[model samples]
Target: MDCLSLLEHVIVTLFLAVLISIYMNKGREEFFRILLLGLKSLPGMQGLISRVLKGEVTNFVKQVNLDETTKGGKRPPRVVIPKKGIPYDELREAMAKFKAAETNHVEGKIFAYTYTLFDEHFQLQKDCFKIFGEKAGYSENHDALVSLFHQAFLHENALNPMIYPSLRRFETEVVSMAAAMLNGNENATGFLTSGGTESVLMAVKTYRDRARKLFPHIKEPNIVAPITIHPVMEKAAHYFGLKVYHAPVGPDFRVDVQAMEKLITPNTILLASSAPQFCHGIVDPIDKVSELAVRRGLPLHIDACFGGFMLPWVEKLGYSVPDWDFRVPGVTSISADIHKYGYVVKGASVVMYRNEELRKHQIFTYAEWPGGLYGSPSMAGTRPGGNIAASWAAMRALGEEGYMSKAKELMEATIKLKDGIRKIPALEIIGEPCMTCFAAQSTDPEVDILAVSDVMETKGYKMEKQQKPSSLHFSILPHHVPFVEPLLQDLAKSCDEVKANKTLAKKGSAAMYGMVATIPDKAIINDFIVEFFSEVYKCN
Candidate 1:
């Protein structure tokens, strides 16, 4: 090899390395994440490192195991298909056994997820499911009742109105109902999504595409949102190739409107705030943020996924709820989860827009295919009909009167719970919650919030723990109404017990959460989460 050739090779290599570093540094957090992941993938290195840190790794694994067992006893059977099919009766028995191992959310033993109503209402939902089990909206050959139920399912192919006219009608009506509830005018239109995440994703995608069309010269798009905005928005930005600039919140846990506005730039395509954000159950200053959005000529998205179904009724019942929905003039879109507060079976959410023109950006169409053209309304191509049908049935069965009554009960329970927490000297509510969900942080240094959570779990109350200022979250559902007093009593006892022995924080899930919160290197936390998900998906 010649000296000149070697010199040129070195120069090119160094130049490429510099360019790669610059590209990665553009998004430093994600860049470090990818770098760590690449290093972990090196052959034999990860295992060798794990062996070297055996003691630390083993303690983390033990904590994971303890947390899993504390949540629900032993793991369920990981069964593969049998060589020959089993009888239906045997399969049913096995299924029942597996289900028996889970925490009974119906009895209010669980708290974080799984919303339910009175037994009769639940039975009605079950009956509806049974009645429509064999039906699919893809076909038109069914009885009138089944056809009516089938209307709820909107297929991706339904973009061609001729294909599934009923689907279009059902979806339109659903969006209209949601829009009216949120105080949207006649121009409002949207489509039903599988869940809240997809709804938020669609909104992000819409705004990104809108920017691409209107500001073609802009190289990168960004969204300015409150730090408390649902993590789904972050996921959306990651998936759609956009950046998120999170604005700091105030001590009240609501978005600081001034801070959010200052983050907006020419490349900012969307501004977002949550209606009672999931962490602390405090609504951001939507009205104030809307003013900024209007002035900046940017689209604003209100994420009401957690509070949408309940807030209007709460306000109707005389609670002073903030302006968070379509009623706000500058609010361009809103995402609401029907499954959460609507008391419907899972996999149902609504995403609404102020006008059809904005919704056009959400729709996708592909032509020039050999098999003809294709179009999809949301992310998924073939969505489950049962989710939509069951949601419709649940909503219809629980009419406005039923929902209002339930909301009243939930609010009353929330009041009692908040009052109870306030009574505890060691704990304090994170903020003035606008809805039934709220978090309680430890006020006394001796009372570890995570330890309190562990004790609450032992008492058979499933409590969700949060970070960034450690706290325990509660979502008071109708099922929880009966158990509110008991929960408070247990919580009080737990606080006292934890305060008595600060070392309790060194054990079980408390220790794990403490480690996660205090860890400076988030890459390790990310790896832990990835590993935990891998464990969840393992069959054996």
Candidate 2:
């Protein structure tokens, strides 16, 4: 065998040996768990897992939606109008009933939706959708059903961007907007991605590719980020074959720059800090990280998918926002989601680099394919034109002035709520969020935050609960701003009511969340997640 072939074989052998060693060291259970996680990272394995998860999630939704004891028990007509259409009024009544059932299921009841609950904001969104929905997808070039669908199709096949020029255009605009928001200049360039996860994936991939080209001798690539950095980085590391070195966070939930500095090694491809992490809405030390990256010749990525669109305005409105953008010298790339705070529909996000040179690492090229020569700037095969249009529309509609007003309203409401929550002795605000989204925990040992969340669920708040600290999350939207005081008042009352009341029977999906958190074996949790997907896809 040639030297290169022999070297590859040796590397594969070493990889296998390492796996075996880990399996031996950690025992079969832990080893298999990690191995399965590793398997899930593989492209083939990822697709399989995704399908399974989708199916399970679908089935779960069906079951919950059709639960006989609940209000939405009546199923839709099975055989879809095989005979003839019903009368107009009859059809309208049926539609209304169905709408009511769905509304009952969602109205002030679901926390995960992250929209305004029956307020002007909610009405405004509906009005926007109503006004735009019919006309939204009517582009002759691409007859998209929804604006989201259009965006979904913009580059649905990014593997062949030449075939879909619109995707390139959409991507270009998205990146330019993201970079401008992050203070990137003419030197900056970027691409559109599926979501925050894919954006993170591409950033890691780009850095790895750059490392491969520049420092070929460095075999092992590692990413350094705070513990609070979204798990997507870990997912990216796993998918692209890189190691993760976590830096600890302070009580304020911000990354410790000193600890991060100590963790950087010769193989470190990327340094990361969050504009504001998912769990707690606290921005990391981006300026410090950027300075460090510059000194070390490492590429630093600021993940602002959660806070990118909001923070800029927040900073402009005179909040204590830090320089977590391209303004920093070494800040190489940034990921921002137009879907989240951008108030556009989902399936839109951007990954931007400080300069074209660094961005070159993000492009994928293929010289050989049966169909044709293929190349893509981002990960996806196809892009969505409607989403791009909708996002662009959303941006245009909500210009700087509009966003500033929204930011101001949201900040005021958030501060009021934070102060109100702090007044309650049992519950404490998790961190000082610059914007609306924040987390809270129960200080009283007897009071389970999950239980409190369950109680809030009963009250129709539908807040999300978290583990690893056992807290509840709240993403305050512009819609929720007005209800902030009332929500806090209800929350305080809920705590009192729960404290005074008897232990009632557990009802609804809150129990499942609690159960998931308590499971000691992570494999079982994985199995449950897999099973959950299996259940989701069940039609009956």
Candidate 3:
């Protein structure tokens, strides 16, 4: 009787334990679900996720070894202000050593991240930067260089225009020049920004604010943009509490205007398209989109950041380009990077609006600050005067004639490169590219484009990999002009090698890219990328 009772009790105890464990697991799952929902509602959370997933966080971590922990348990050197300063020469030597590992972009082998120029033009910019480096536009220094800098910085932080009339004047002139090139009328007004990303951000922010004022009932403002529109637009939408409705693109990689129109709703605050999108370097149908915007009574923003400086000349050279600027009646704003094709050093772009009323929305001013009245035109608070000065100097130095000549050369080189690419039967251009920037895909299944990229890398050529339809992107610059034939030869060789060794597609970046591209659950991919970022940021 005692053994039977004990066995029954043990069985009951085991059953109770199993029941409890199941309930606890359910509770944990519910808790995680609630936590994830909360995280999704938070602003910039997706941005942080996207940044981590996009390899930016990993790239940053690779560039900086911030962790001090070491395997030997030794105290690592801390980066602190030295009690005694080192000699300038010694400091320079240290800096040179630090930079020794960086890619030699000047050699023209690298593409995707850099835009190089003629050595002489670069020298001119460097000299201008050095002269204006220390002087802020706020300073009253009236020397010619300072005066030029003052002009460049004037309207940038135009809250107090009286401080530097020259800055306002130069800024106006720069804006006017950009507007004229973009075919905008006298009503066009804009301000210089830090870069293309900032310019795009400002445009998004301005349109968002305008929508808030005009359509008060709209709770969730959204932007209609091509899938190929710069990712910065998505970032801007994330930061400003706007939703981005990405419209599908056609086989040409250009946004389908009808599909984009279908995505528009009453809450649609802005319509955007790229002038030669960054991925495939094909312009969206801005004319058709502009007509749609006009019909819908909405604002259209042309993100010509990459093509702003080059496309105008391309058109002037008798190349057929679609109407993409303010000349279109419905277009309200445009952002063009002076850094990309403008031949300006890496930190200047312009966002032009149809009128002052529209531009005012981009301005941020807080008069209630304890210190004093504070305001900012674009994203940054303390704008770099040197960037403005250098940009201005570059523009003025190049002039219309210089830019035209350079554009002609770049176009010719682009033609040569495209012609060479055509000669490679396995490789095909992604779309009908309108500018020097374009992408190419491997048509033959035996040759993986990503594998070709890896092979090209081994040949000392860096190429950008594009998804959707897997391909390789190239943005030709003055430096790339000389390397056009060489790049073509390398591309052909890489394609041949990849075609010969099908297994190469399963190695290096090709393997990673191919695997990620085929993954249905992007969350898993994002998690993996976030883990990569974590590993990259690990100091030890």
Instruction: Tell me the whole-model lDDT of each prediction, alpha carbons only.
Output: 0.77, 0.72, 0.78
Which tens-of-lDDT digit does each residue in 1-540 have in candidate 1?
Answer: 899999979976875585578566677666666556665767898877667787685567566432222436463232221223333344335334534644454565743323456578765664564434555432322122233343323212333433333344445555766777888877887888989999999999999998898899877899999888899999999999999999999989988889887898878999999998999899988889999999999999999999989998899899999888888888999999988897766678999999988998998889968977787889987655545654544554455776788899999999999998899999999988889999999989899999999998988878898888889889988779888878889999999999998889899888998778788999999899999999999999
Instruction: Give the lDDT of residue 74 in candidate 2.
Output: 53
Q: Write the per-residue lDDT of candidate 2 for residues 83-106, one digit (tens) a residue.
A: 122233442343334334432323
The digit string of per-residue lDDT tens for model 3 on 1-540 reads 699999979976875575567557778666566556656657889677666765774555445643234678564442221223333344334334433544454566554333446578765654554435555432322133334443333323333443333344446667877887788776788999989999999999998888777788999999999999999999999999999999999988889999998999989999999998999889898889999999999999999999999999898888888888888898999999988888766678999999988998999989889977777888887565545654555555556776778889999999899988989989988889998888998889899999999999998877798888898998999889778878888899999999999899999998999789788999999899899999999999
Q: What TM-score does candidate 3 get on C-alpha atoms?
A: 0.72
TM-score of 2: 0.69
Give the Cα error of residue 458 in candidate 2, in Å: 0.9
Give the poorly placed runs of model 1, Cα more than 4 Å off.
1-164
Candidate 2 local Cα displacement, residue 393, angstroms: 1.9
Model 1 scores worst on lDDT over the 10 consecutive residues at: 76-85
- Which residue pairs collide in model 3, if any? 67-539, 151-166, 151-167, 154-167
Backbone clash count, each prediction separately: 0, 37, 4
**Clash list (residue pairs), candidate 1:** none
